[model samples]
Target: MFGWRRRNRTGRKTGRSKKQQFKLDKESVLPNHFRCPISLDLMKDPVTLSSGITYDRESIEKWLEDGNFTCPVTNQVLRSFDRIPNHILRKMIQEWCQENQNSGVERIPTPKVPVTGTEVYEILSSIEASMKRLDQCGFLESLKKINKWGFESERNRKCIVDNGTATTLANAFVTFSSDDHHQSLESHNYNVLEEILSSLNWMFPLENDARKILGSKPSLNKLVLLMKRRDFLSTKNAILVVEELCYDQEFIEALVGIEEVQEVLVRFIKEPICHAITKASLMVIFSMVSSSNHDHERIKTQFAEMGLVTLVLNMLIDGEKHLNEIALGVFDRILDSKEGREAACGNDLTMPVLVKKILRVSELATEYSVSSIWKLSRIEKQSNEGRVLFEALQVGAFQKLVLLLQCGCGDSTKEKATQLLKLLNPYRAGLECIESSDFKNLKRSF
Candidate 1:
């Protein structure tokens, strides 16, 4: 009886071990066929099958929509919904569906919410508050103190290299230069004027105080002298300050106006600094006369007859790209004045050289070279200077136009170029030049 019982017990244990091994094999094999092609994740949530089939909720749906769907590993066609013939797999999916339903889980798409007027107002308010806090922060105060010291000690040379003072000075110079009130503040008490000049290198931590001082009329001459003595290297900053002083309506109405400022600026333009600052100063002077309410022909003619046009044109020929833009702007403004244009024409200085520069600029525009092209074209349009426009087309401007045409791109530059070309009648001269040149091969590359 004991021997018989031992045999039965051993047989039962062996049978149970075989059943466990079969279950493991089934689980491993099931995943190999059911893996998703896109993510290679174990297939769930509306799983499809092979044989042009789809099986959702144990119901066969025929002719599943055709796309790139296939087996992830073997890349076989998944044709029909009934392709997953494994009964265990179907039972498992049905069980999962029932569980999800019982748990009350519903998959709903999220709706997007749009911002209202109130939300927009709140956002802007937050930004303004943050900016106010940043403006009054301790670091800004330290920067102001350092720049004050730099300007007082005549350490302009060293201050430019020190990033903190340089940035502060740049901001202060731009702010003071743009403020009408600051120009008025300059004509106030001498002590206040001195303080303002000394602290010119510092950022204005107090915007209201700075604005008030700048708007007031102080001695601009004294400020200019101080800046010259300090050897401030930034010409752009210096020119802006000078512009504010030159164009101050109340200050211009006073005795010390464009006449006095012009003499000082012309001297500065002759100084050995970056050409851009000098060019900018020239533009400011031209703009002052052009936009002035005062009858400043005497001043304008004085500037034009002083060989200013020659100086500006020379700078345009050799100046860097940014300076080129300013030089072009100055030329355009000068041409706008009948007195200035007559003066330029009387000197026999208007055409060929200036026109050549415009043409060269047009060629550069095709390559999307610089922002200066738009300004240059604007000047070209205003001046009605067509000789150089024709000359530019004769010298391969048409080839650039053709190349741009093939690319089928439209921008301000291409549009301007096309308009300029139309005025010049490029087909007669420019088209001939292009046909004679090797532009045919170049166009093929496009």
Candidate 2:
């Protein structure tokens, strides 16, 4: 009886194994036409079937849960869960899940978004279209509006400041000061400048326009009123604006039309402690000086005779290391002109005094003083009174030159010293004096 029971159990196990083998053979027999086109590895994530349909693992699971499991291949609709053949579907799902989990990513479908290229092009095209509509009159009107707005803004800023508002006023004066408007205006197209300037006036005020507003009698009256109040800051701003205007060829021509502009500027220069004002004034003067058509000699004579030489010399004396270059440049300009040269080398006493000052400065070992002295000696017109100049240079000046030569200060300084020595040693005065020294022991030491 035990043998019969064991045989019966073996027979059941054999039948179950045969059924499983049959299902595996059926699945393996399916054609390759059912494969997905994308990966070509087995159909996995969101696999598409031969019926032009795609199903994720979730969709297939839902179909099975609803008792609708079918291959649609053999029309073999499965009834029992046991009859449903496992087709490595779980393996594919496991692989996709592991890939996503390892990468820490989730698959998302792309959303449809509209293109903006055409809209951007349309906006740019509209700007290009409107550029043609800008005419001279329209431009002038726009400029006027700009000027009005600027004036209002300035007034508002002042009002805010008065009321102790936290808003900071725009530094209009500083902006005007810093701008390289002279170069900009010269390079800019005139029509564009006219438009820009007109726009500026409309926004700010006509107070700054030296040609249009300041050139007029009423504007001059208003400026005189502001000037009388000793509002130097505002005066400075006005001068800057005028200087920029003076840089403009057309504006300069208009200024030449009215003698009042020059008169006002000249009067301003005459005032005491007008260094800041003088800077702007000098720009205008320099502009005129640079012109080929202008009579520069007359201006040079005028400035020289007006004590400008003394003022500039005093400036040089007071100027520290930083202003040395400017002072030297000013000295050079003064010495270049005949009137300036005369003023500097004039009074027989001035050259000696200058020579002494140069010696003192050189002894202090200021490079700028040494350089300036070297330059002055080269340009100075020699006279019988050069004896005093020679004496001043001789006392310790030669020692300074030797020191510079030893240090290799510069070729120019060495060359200058050589030239100066040659000048001083006319008729072998220096060499004869040196040879006469009791050098019996000195020669032996060498």
Candidate 3:
């Protein structure tokens, strides 16, 4: 390749091919055609969808995996998810990288050949044989293969999940949980169980029958026992499985019905094993708290009575932004019940924390916190020791409430905010003039 030289600012001769990292800017622009529409990065393994648009194999596969049946660019219903390999384009990218090697462009290796149905069947058969013969060592090896293959590409995972690997794994999980086999292999049990759950997490949106297997009361009781293992990997995987299966109304209600399950989830929240597990636990509990299967009030009251109110308040006090937002949403939902309200009011920190989170967190957090305040304050000012309003007023909630109305919110939230303002208006006398970063945005004329 011919090379050229350029001059530096000091008039020294410098090479034009000086190695540097490429970023999205005019100086080192990546060709538009080389970039995947979904990720906007140079495609290492381009594949054309049936819609005739090319994207990185991984990006497009993930899009389809998320249940989008249409082209992301065209939004047209896809007749198929077939993604033909664009080999020619990949070669062009390689040549360009070779010509610009000095510019830090590395050659993209060819993507792994997508897993075939036959390959998946071979692994599934191995898992089944090992399980039937009670070969613990063989069973663990086969599960390792499933986890590995599923990680290579979304296509592989699709193949694994579609070939009924999920049901097989679920059945194996049930046996391990119910049978006494696990107790004998105490130390090795963690590895086998972790792989099973880690692989299962990749097969979410489980089939209805599969959902029932994991949702059964016995399975759930065992799931609690697994969590108590205190192994981070196993606990995280277990939480993710429950989070996905919890999409079903029946699974949620079933988990809630188990006192042990409730206690375990609450413990996970009170002292998280890790951030990811903690967040997933919140999602599962949120689903449980939000269920409308038969009696909505019953579900709300159940969580409210389990010290969820106090836990949420404490989380809001120190949780990160997104986690705080979720905690507030749960707080608002539970507040719909009398028990939830009583629990909040009983804790003297409730009003202060709820009022504090209103404008201090994200928009969604603000809405939920405001809604919670409205719910807690909706009762007669004469009732509940007047703790709701007086405590709110004592914390300067009246000013924050005014600022919230100034910022605006959903129509329902808007109405509730307005009603809240009216309720707190009479107590506004002698309060310091509203002042804060949020107050500066207020229209002086209004």
Candidate 4:
């Protein structure tokens, strides 16, 4: 009976052995020690949480990202979300995978060492000490490291700024900028300035107080001179810092008083600088003109004659979609003054291009573009500029308004569009081609 059973089992195994071998050739299950508790897979860049739980770095980071203050598995309260790298475990996993290569396992690649806030703090401390002795090389290197780390995480950025990173960076910027004034700027100086710029760029979305502190420290003249630098990085940072500085009325006045400031800004606005630089420059202009004050009006006149109205209109016509909304926003601000209104309406392309942007971009863009038309139309209605009214008619402004009402916009935008249509009601003959049901339905409301 035993012999018969053995023969039968051998017969059953003959065809199944190859299939079983194929299954075994696949990657074997990872040993528990080599697996992340969170991922339940072989650990890649294993780290120990404050809860004393080991997990994959990315998995644990994501858990923390989801706003968890406890370990996912243990449910224990975590004193901190900071992770300690389990280098020994990572090495063991790598060696184990290498030893198990016959089972078709792939080696886990090493992970990049992330920059920590502590590291940034230490660097800042060293730079603070070095700055006292006027040795900038170490300060420059440390600033570069801080900038790099700032880009890594929002938490790290906040840490840097909260620790007075901007004040430190601002002082360095002024020092280097003043040094350049005493001599022709060397390549090394430009390199140092560029690094300072990188840090400033990362340190933005700052509070008004922080901006004020930074702006005052760097000094307006130094910032404007930095704006004259032709390099993309420094130019971009210069304008960004200037825009933030313009939050203060005095700084705005000071910046506009600088003759080179407007020239450099307009030149780059028309020049082939990167879109980011152009955007920053436009925002500075916007901030200057956004507020209603004597200084703002004067600055508006300064920019209007410099052909800012024309330049913004042309940007609207030819610029990318990302730039369209900002251009319209600045265009709206430019409309606050009589000179700006005349500049905007004087352009043959302005009415047509302005009308084209109504529903073509974002809702915010539509609101701004429509608001600009309202401003122009309001001025025309009061001044009896039949020619300007005729231009809006010729550009299908009335029809776009009718369509905008039908399509639905923000409440304020809808009201502005309605108000604009009423202003243009005398020119309703221009919209004679409207035949769509939506347009027809909207006409009754109009």
Best by TM-score: 4
Give per-residue lDDT, candidate 4, residue 423. Answer: 77
Top candidate (lDDT): 3
Candidate 1 local lDDT, 353-445, one digit each (tens): 344444245444233321222334345567877544454455455455555556554576567556655655634542444322332222110
Model 2: runs farther than 4 Å from truth?
1-231, 242-275, 281-294, 319-324, 347-384, 391-418, 425-446
Q: Which model is ahead, 1 or 4, in terms of lDDT?
A: 4
* Cα lDDT for residue 258, candidate 1: 26
lDDT of each: 0.44, 0.42, 0.77, 0.74
lDDT of 4 by residue, 282-336 (tens): 7777777886566777777878888888788778756889988888988898888
TM-score of 4: 0.79
Q: Number of clashes in every candidate structure?
A: 27, 8, 0, 0
lDDT accuracy of residue 267 in candidate 2 = 53
RMSD of each: 22.4, 26.9, 8.5, 8.6
- lDDT measured at residue 31 in model 1 versus the true structure, 0 to 100: 46
How does candidate 1 fare on TM-score? 0.40
Q: What local lDDT score does residue 300 receive in model 2, on the 0 to 100 scale?
A: 54
Whole-model lDDT, model 2:
0.42
- The predicted structure with the larger TM-score, 3 or 4, is 4
lDDT for model 3, please: 0.77
RMSD of 3: 8.5
- Residue 313, candidate 1: alpha-carbon lDDT: 56
Model 2's TM-score against the true structure: 0.36
